[model samples]
Target chain A: MSCDHLDLALASGLDLLGPDEAREFALHLPGCPACRAEVETSRLLLDALAFSAAAPAPRPALRRAILRRAQASRWRLPGPVAAVLLVALFCAALWLGATRFPVLPAVTRTASGYIIASLDPTARSPHAKGEVMLLPEAGHILVMADGLAPLRAGRVYEAWLLTRGGAHALGPLHLDGWGYAWLHARVPPGAFRGLLVSVEPARPGPGPSGSTVLATSGDAK
Target chain B: MQEADLPRRLARGDARALAELYDRFAPGVFSLALRRLEDAGAAEEVVQDVFFKIWHGRALFDATRGDLPAWIFAIARNTVYDQLRRRLRQSRLSEAQAAMLDLFATSGFEALEHLMAQEHIAELLAALTPEQRDLVRLVCVDGRTVAEAASLLSTPLGTAKSRLRAALARLRQTLATEVRAQ
Candidate 1:
């Protein structure tokens, strides 16, 4: 037996229904076994179709990077503590103004041991731009970026310190409505090659897993 | 490690389990992304995003509800859709068209117990008439709506819809027979 929702079932199985239509179909699915079977069969077909695509092996480095990130995730602080620390650091930054930490416009080394690096956009995000400021003596790194394309839900921009070993997660770069974000983090003791910002899932991973939005030349390497 | 034990190991924060999961599914995830995005770099990003979610969100996986591979592929599918949506937005497509693209967005589904191998799937696709194949490609592979596929193929909307329905039914019946034979 057929019902009025047959077309809706087909479209839903193909993932061609909008949110509203899909929801309506979903509500009707439990009561209608015919529509349910149609949806299941269509999904099965699509799943088979998905496997038809060519499967090229990913680069080995990508695998290593993911593993390293997974390992580092073990050391991450709990959410509440991290948030409190971030707030304290932001308050500290406000207290120490231009006199203590003067903003440098170009890639220059100030006598106060502040090293600045420019972050250029990658092909993935051409219009995005950023700057990195490093104060090694004080063990602080400041990242400022703008012109970023807004990410979809459950995604965010994250900063990482690139080293000879692997990437070290800085933290999430919280962006305002204008696609501007600034992150302040203590520079971990290590020989750093450069820094980069990547688009990552909302649940932060230890390494750069998403597309590189902004990066130093060295970091891109 | 047994496939059935993966979810448990991953939830216990076993790094080896994550690596094993990646080894099993990375190629399929990359292939799906590369097919949809057609850019190697972007496809790699999708691979990373998929694994990252699988690793970090392991606790959310309930083996009672679905198997691990199905859950993994669901994440892969959703991530690819996100990439597509981002591309549509960046291209400055009109709001109406963007809304239409939303129709293709999925909230994940339970995957089949076994997907046909690439060669087998290709062979099955080859069994379809050329017109039916093109219609499937336009809507399923190219992410086009039925109306859009109809317009592009110079066919009536109702005809295109019927062709798609027929194509899916044929494939499903063939696949079910193959499964039973196994």
Candidate 2:
């Protein structure tokens, strides 16, 4: 096929091509630098997306919430509705003289994927230290850290996904009562080269306006 | 744990095995849903549902046929499509909205294509003009033939073809520049 036809064919999406034509294109593709590059572009797009999809991890509470609801019953209900049901069930059990409620197991979310980078505290943010785990296939990044001080009333710690495109604020890192925080971002693996943590104003700006207190030591794997 | 062995353990009714699987796949599954749905609560719901199906419906997956990630991602795609449909049905959707619904639905390919195509490409794709984006939604996202997208958009087939080429080219250009910038 001509290059024009090949471009149209690729743009038409794979479903358009007949099996024979697709097979023929596959045979022809290896020798054609241009077509090969186009195909690679498609793959790279998917990779970038996969990274973005995994950028935000679900709230940790979601796990306990999901497991609790799943254990409570097989019925699928929204989180608030499920909470109401559980409360009602508890009240009824109390009225009926049953004293025990189901015990919730300790829930921990471990990164089942590879380590993208291990971050250390910068001189400006000497208390910060953590590692970023990448679930590439899953399209998620988990950043957990300790020794972070609670921000002032109007301040927040924002995590940035430093990519060639630019620094994207992953979201505000919410620290729990104990000064420990885990930020979940839905970023595709290797889409960004590094991670940066900055203490910003209460509201975020286009980019970091505060000091880079913590960051990845090297290129993100 | 080995990914291959996890499913086998799950099939044997190990709760720990299921947890291990969840630890491994939840973020990926959740990310896919979040990118598509753009709602954490809904995305979380999707992740919970995907894992539930995997553990309870283990028999439906035959390992001899394919590996676990492919099977899990197939379920993820179908679940995301279901969520999209539910959202679409809840509102009086516009043509653009309906086009988005059609775009994300995975009908043609088996697992791998669904997984790859379902990744969050909206950012890179945002480089295209609105017109080009619509064409791409129809052709790539919706898995429509270029001719079909052309007909749906009421544009000539050649125009649709050129628009798609331009859009893909733009995506490549942006990606290349970004990589160099990094």
Candidate 3:
């Protein structure tokens, strides 16, 4: 019929409707197949983009650059905010760093020789975690210490190679205040099984004695 | 690590990589801002702001927590919204910018109508004169409600609604014809 009146019929909006006009429109939609299709088309498009607005992608370079800028400008953030952000970052980094991939201190193994880095009683880890070492000298093994905190006076440490049979004493490891440590010892042919560090009483003895401080397996490098 | 890797590379001062990312997304960002701000210069500025955010504001982007694209978009969106609010607050539009804004108003609707290939939408848009085409684009593609379009066009709501209804009628008629032909 006369769609000149159709303007009045449609302005109520394709998506929205009032009670009486909506009822009339509903009746007309099923009967008037064309209007039904038209409504369906509009509805489809609207449905296609209902919740989210269609966004064109940003340039990758621009995106990366802007993100970089945003991150940098974060430094320009006000003091309290910056502090809070940093603290949060520091905590996150520390947690991730600690749990995920803690650094493994580098070790140099000598060819044709066995090595070990024994621990002394007062010697402690400079870092929260540390690595003891084994080096080979000819047919013997030289042990080393790395990342251990310096020792306090009136104390010493001992080292032992624990095996399937029992523990063997590698003897006295020494260190001055920090960084890397080198200990000299003979790698008994079978003592190559496992090695450990223990905080021993201040006297040097011919045995793996005193309390076991921090014992670790002495294995092939 | 993959997520942090780029920003970390960027953190140490890599500019070329950032440019690569820029070329990738500029079109979408430009089109988005153009639709919202309706000014080429403002849109360009919006794009620049988006670039600055990704390049210099790497800290704001938590790749571990979110996708880079999403972060970039959020920032771009905020920049556009902020500019919109500022434009609204300004009591007077300098004659030059006002002139540019009016450019989008002229024949703008026809351009949008021409883009409307769907039989139903084409029918709806055919009833509108080129002048009313601008109103339809503002409502549809650019996402303005009729009330918003009326304010934008500086016309009465009744006038805009009337044009909308007429346009919608045309769409139905066009759709009806297309349906019969099919």
Candidate 4:
């Protein structure tokens, strides 16, 4: 194939080429320096791009709309209209409120894929700190501490990665309140396996430092 | 995801699909925009606009038109080009000032490309507007930060940021094209 045709063929969908066109494009690769270089570079870039690694973005709105449209997804009653239902619900609510009702059941959100854990504890009498919130796909993992004594300003609560073998210092998480200290950890491959928080100096290294303030052990959950 | 499946979800106005698509390419896209626009604000605005359009376009996308990434990239490229044309027509920036805006606007992924390219970063300098060429000489060649470059140019920080981002994204795309041509 000529260089122009060869280039056009390469950019066009790979599936569309007949055997001859595909073969002709490959033949041009051997003799043409510019085209050969172009082919190799494009291949490398596309390879590195990991195009197939893309995952489907969850369509929450679509799910909601689908559920709304599909009548089986929700229960609906047609009869005595909204006024009667509102009055009945209001009466029930009032009766419950007047009788010194028990506290309402805790409504908590369920999260997908948690880091589950069980850990070894030192016999030394000490309280372990705990915190939780949504984490992004990247950046420093923010671990926090709360309801604890004020740590020295320069001092931070360092987080640690625990293995059956030993411990690695994650990093010092900045402390905000007795109820809040953030352990900023660089997420490494499998680093999220098990985490321990330590109150180390404002500067902490790759291994655990100072005392363990809050600790958690988790398996993939 | 199966090409057939996305349209159905999108038709229902599923925002999560938009998020998923963003997750797949947004970093590179944003980084590309940042490289061109230099200012994070402009680059971010472009990225957000692209996704917002996709989110609102739930029922509009057709599976047979093209692959999503290339389509998205084309839209992004057009958006950047439109911004450049709009700024040039509206602002009347001087040649010296415009040069500084494009120079040093790139950071995040040019750094990554450098790491991956085995020291062969291709001819980035040759790909520039004359004004951008001057900015390269003054800031990058002289090691000036955005603040330093802005002070030297006697321009507002906002203008500098926008120009820098636009320039960087252009340079990065140019380099990407050149690298592909290798």
Q: Candidate 2 chain A: minimum summed lDDT over ten consecutive residues — where?
A: A101-110
lDDT of 3 at A1: 36
DockQ (0 to 1) for model 1 = 0.16
State the DockQ, from 0 to 1, for candidate 2. Answer: 0.08
Assess each prediction's global lDDT (C-alpha) against the native.
Answer: 0.65, 0.56, 0.46, 0.41
Per-residue CA lDDT of model 2 for A1-221, tens digit only, reads 23744553344233334567666765675466556545534543432244334344567787665555434423233346545643553343233332221111111111122223445577787756555544444335556555777777888888886665667776676464444555554554345456788889878898899987778763211
CAPRI accuracy category, model 2: incorrect
lDDT of 3 by residue, A103-168 (tens): 112221212121222232223442322233332212233344444555667656566655455565
Name the candidate that leads on DockQ: 1
TM-score of each: 0.43, 0.38, 0.29, 0.28
Taking the tens digit of each residue's C-alpha lDDT, what string does model 1 give over A1-221?
67888767656665556689878987887687677666655654564465344345689999998888777764453456656865665454333322223332323342224455667788998877666656554456667676788889999888887655567677787553434566656554333457889999987776788999888763210
Which candidate, 2 or 4, would have the higher DockQ against the true structure?
2
Cα lDDT tens digits for candidate 1, B1-182: 69778788897778899999888778877877765576789889888767766655554455664456656655565566555555673785454334333433321123243344444667778878999998887776555678999999999988887788788767766765776686
How does chain B score by TM in each prediction?
Answer: 0.60, 0.59, 0.48, 0.49
Mark the regions of model 3 whose C-alpha exceeds 4 Å error after superposition. A1-221, B1-5, B92-182
Model 4 misplacement above 4 A: A1-221, B1-4, B92-182
* Distance from true location, Cα of A109 in model 3, Å: 54
